[model samples]
Target: MIAHNNMKSSPRLENEHEHENEPNNLIMKKLLSRCWEESRLLWRLAFPALLTELFQFSIGFVTTGFVGHLGEVELAAVSVVENILDSSAYGVLFGLGSALDTLSGQAVGAGRLERLGTYTQQSWIICSATAVALTPAFVFATPILKSFLHQPPHVSRVAGPYARWAIPRLFAHAMNIPLLMFFQAQSRVWAVTAISGAVLAAHVALTYLAVRRLGCGLRGAAVVGDISHWLIAAAQFAYMRGGCFPEAWKGFTVRSFSNLGAFVKLSLGSAVMIWLVVSIGYGSLEFWYYTTLLVLVGLLKHAKLQIDIMSVCLNYEFMTIMVALGFSTAAGIRVSNELGANRPKETKLAVVVAVSTSAFMGAIFMAFALIWRTSLPKFFSDSPKVIDGASRLGYLLAVTIFMSSIWPVLSGVAVGAGWQVPVAFINVGCYYLVGIPLGILFGFRLKHGALGIWMGMLTGTFLQMAILLAIIFRTKWEKQAELAKMRISEWGGKNENQPLIS
Candidate 1:
């Protein structure tokens, strides 16, 4: 009996010891899981990119607000010019810039440092050439504005000055996009973010002085924007030369021209994607403005005022989009890295975590929009019609926010997987072919105004979300990783035969 009791007690003691360590073990496991799920590695790369975007948008808002104070006519003119630039030139730049993310991320993942540098140089050359080739368009800005939309004579008068002042920004933007993407690809987001923030501060100060104090009006706003872009480009170039990206800058060669054909081939898809999405949006707005009828007082006091308020609301919405970009960027890096590293399970988990987190964030944004639906307009304007328009559209915006969250994250996954072409096609089909046309039909033809336009947009967004979700669910990460490895081998040569560099 004594022997049996001793044996039982020994086992019990062992169990007690395990129980004591169980909590500690659990804690360690939790930390590891969180690290894997959140992918701190990727966030370390994306945080700066996020900050850069935030600063850029914030400066834009401040400049727009300052111009709005000049009078509704000025605001309308600025808006029209901005819409054109966004839909045309800026869209093209951003679309091509996406190539940087894909190329650099994949090269980094495969540990091909030299190739990464080559890609960056090529990107700069291609974007710069495109910018230079496109300069003549700005000189004929008035004609282009007239061709696109009908506006007041005063509004048309401001277009020429705005476009001329904004011309230099195009080159700045061309350089900025690739440089920003280079840092993002290499996981140096913080540097980009810090530099961007400084530039934005300078921009706001200059804009205020030029517009408010110097009385330059819309021209001042345009000039400030151009200066900011140049500053940002210079800072980014300086950083690149300062050995911040030694791997990507080693022996800068003029190898860009050799890759021009391939670059254009890939960029065409991105360009079309951007053009379609932005054109759809611009077309919808134009249709509504032209078709909707209101009294002169209503047009001045209510219609125009509502647009200004919506612009502010849209600024907030754009911020949310930037935040979503953060998650998507992280997703892109994580997916590419894991695929390159031959870790299929981790890649799958990364996508799952990214999408889930984005969905939750969307829910939070929706709640916030819902709660602030009525009070939001007061932040920008006080007109009852403006307030009413905002309040009614708030719910629509919430839904959009949710859809946007899912859309961007999925886009990141596709980009990381080297599937940009197909994704771009999807965007074109949904946004331009389906969404905008329906928006015009409902908003203008049916006389439902902005609400009708939003509903049509919602339809497109939901369809996009569904398509992305389906792709995510059905994709086999392991197979994709295998294919990626084959592509890397074809492009960068054998890893085992090549000497590894520190």
Candidate 2:
């Protein structure tokens, strides 16, 4: 009887254990399914975003390639001019437009689709006016380059005229950035990708004709660039006007022009509410930080050679940045949308998925940078000296590429959460206060030149990355969701549907 009872009890215990394991297996399966689903959603957005960035980047890449063959001096001059324009006008406009990524994204999540059009139009107004105000920088680029930045006179001469010619492109960016963000907020990435790809193809053919076949020189390149940009602006504008987003875009209304001051205040951040900072100037500071490297390189002893090599490296860096920007866009969209929908857990999951994907991609790019260190610069330059200098800087570029994979995503997260003001302060502290000074110290004082300057800047970038990571880790996603709803309410968003998660 005792042996029979023991046998029965063992079987019952085994059955109980099996029942416990069932839940564990089921949980594991559910987690894996969730991850797979999240990945699918993220890539759906990211792949198109990446293609859009690549296509857009190729326009500039093509320009550089053509411009490079003109002569090293021409390449150097154009690089300087491009840097200035990017740091100044482009930076300001892009930064201001980034607010749309947050605002429109949240609006969509909260089912306030109609507000996207108003925000976009308001962005256009602000950026256009800002473009007008910033026009003087292009007009007087030569004097500014020579006197203020201490660039070579000949380089400045070429750069100034080219900059003035490129002014039309500046205004084109003013119109284009808002539209790009507007489209991106709604996950209309494929549209952007298709349009950019078409424009890039046309741009390449036109650039080849103007610069290589027609021998139109720098002026021709500048004019072609202007045309390419305007084409993008016009195409995107037409798309928006074609009733694709009819509910969001209710045709152009006078209402967009009505709340100009309030809109500006919101876009730039309210000084009255210092705790909730959202300064668009963060973009300017970040852009200027990279531009400062070129500036510093120009001041080196072998100024021309330094400029050429640095420009080549910077161009590659910028290309990689476009990839990161793709991730950044996806991250920002996911975070903003999830928060707006009151799905804090999903937002957290989205961030994890995005960062993981970006990290994987970054690793691939780092390997590519390392492997093709010497050969990569050949695309942009024929100079052996330039090639060798860039090759030496390859490791730095690889590290930067890796860091960029994560950094921009965090920035996107910040943008999604409307934490631009804090990040802007971080940018100033890291890039300006720490990086620039250390660069000057290492480059000039220690005679390290471009390598040392870049090292210093990378240090700042690292610090910025670390701090942002910490912030993201410590963030209470639930509170962020609450903040998102509050922000939408402040913006007059009317939620048409109940939230799925709180």
Candidate 3:
């Protein structure tokens, strides 16, 4: 009887183990399916932003094409000055605005509606102060430009008007970015898309009026660009104040110095990282243009014209980058929200979706870049030499685009997860230590020209992406949530033991 009882108990234990394994297998399958679904969701969220980015690029290309008709000197001056201003001002504005997606996403996840408003208000104050501080740089534009580039007397003459007219645009962007960020954090992405579209339309109208009707030449174009930004900012403000974002706009007090300090502490690393990468990368290209190519090859040559054509290509590159950034922003928001809600599995799914979708987008961009290599430059200019040069670089740029797509998405994931410090450090290491140095050596020292510089930058980007990928794979979302709670407590002035997520 005792032997019989033991045999019966052994079968029951085995049956129980099989029942447990069945549920575990089902959970695994569900997770895999969720990851795929999340990718589709990210694509849906990012597509409008991508369309907006393309529209913005069209505006830039149109501006450049118009300026190109004036002559090579005008084209060169516009390219150089625009690059500098964009790297300094726009880069900072974008970086600061990214903080909104980071903080507000988590706040929303934690069900802290009031905190979202506070974050938006704080971003405006901090970004506005930064804009004020940056104004002096514009005041000293000529001297600053001369310090970097061997600006020929004629180039300096044209660049002066362009820089002066364009400088104030940065201040306008300071306001616009924060407002856009607030909308984006709330997943009101269509608002920004509409605003950006309207801004671009206004810019086109103003560009035509300034250049053709008013005969302001490039100066008119610059002035119109600046004014359009202010118009966009005003429109966004009206929309927000007109009851679209009443909850986010309520109790809006000017941020105290302490709050600003805290915001800066959270944001400066990412800002510095972006600034350094953009500045150094553009600076390297400009240095190559002035030192190596511009002097050796005159404007009449195929090479010189090709260099001008590359500017148009660069605009397309920017569009691709912005698309990637859009998805990254969405990923960051989703991941942050899930983490804040203490849904580790969901956060992991969001990250997987972001990375995979970015990879697919990168592949698509690469295909387009390759297919359109010959015809792309013709859209901007009539020169065959320019088109050929652009085609050669276009192939390489496609790879860069694909690689870059992964970066913003993965970086966004980290940002949403509050891994900014680590990501910032990785950027510094890859971009500054590896990318810049290699680009300088290849472009200037080895005289490989623009292609060499791009190769170096691409290598650095690849390394940075790799590091971020490793971090994402190894991270424990549960632990991240605990840390986030601690941070929220510190920020909200709550007890250490207080749970922010619940």
The whole-model lDDT of each prediction reads 0.69, 0.85, 0.68
RMSD of each: 5.9, 3.3, 6.0
- Candidate 2 wrongly placed segments (more than 4 Å): 1-10, 272-280, 495-502
Residue-wise lDDT of candidate 2 within 1-502, one digit each (tens)? 9999998899899999999999999999998898899899988888898888888877777898889988889989989988656446787887888777788999888988888888888899988998998899899999999999998888999899899998898899899989988888899879878899999999999999999999998999999999998988899999998889988888787777776666777776766353222344676666778899899988998898899898888888888888888888889999999999999999998988888888899999999999999899998888888889889999999998898778888888888888888888887788888999999999999989889999998899889888888889889999999999998887754542222111
Q: Which parts of model 1 are misplaced by more than 4 Å? A: 1-39, 151-154, 268-309, 374-388, 494-502
TM-score of each: 0.83, 0.95, 0.84
Best by lDDT: 2
Best by TM-score: 2
lDDT of 3 by residue, 85-145 (tens): 5545666666666666677877777766666666777777767777887776666666655
> Ten-residue segment with the worst summed lDDT in candidate 2?
493-502
Q: Specify the poorest-scoring 10-residue window by lDDT in model 3.
A: 282-291
Count clashing pairs, candidate 2.
0
Clashing pairs in 1: 48-189
Report how far off residue 114 is in candidate 2 (Å): 0.8
- How would you order the candidates by TM-score, starting with the best? 2, 3, 1
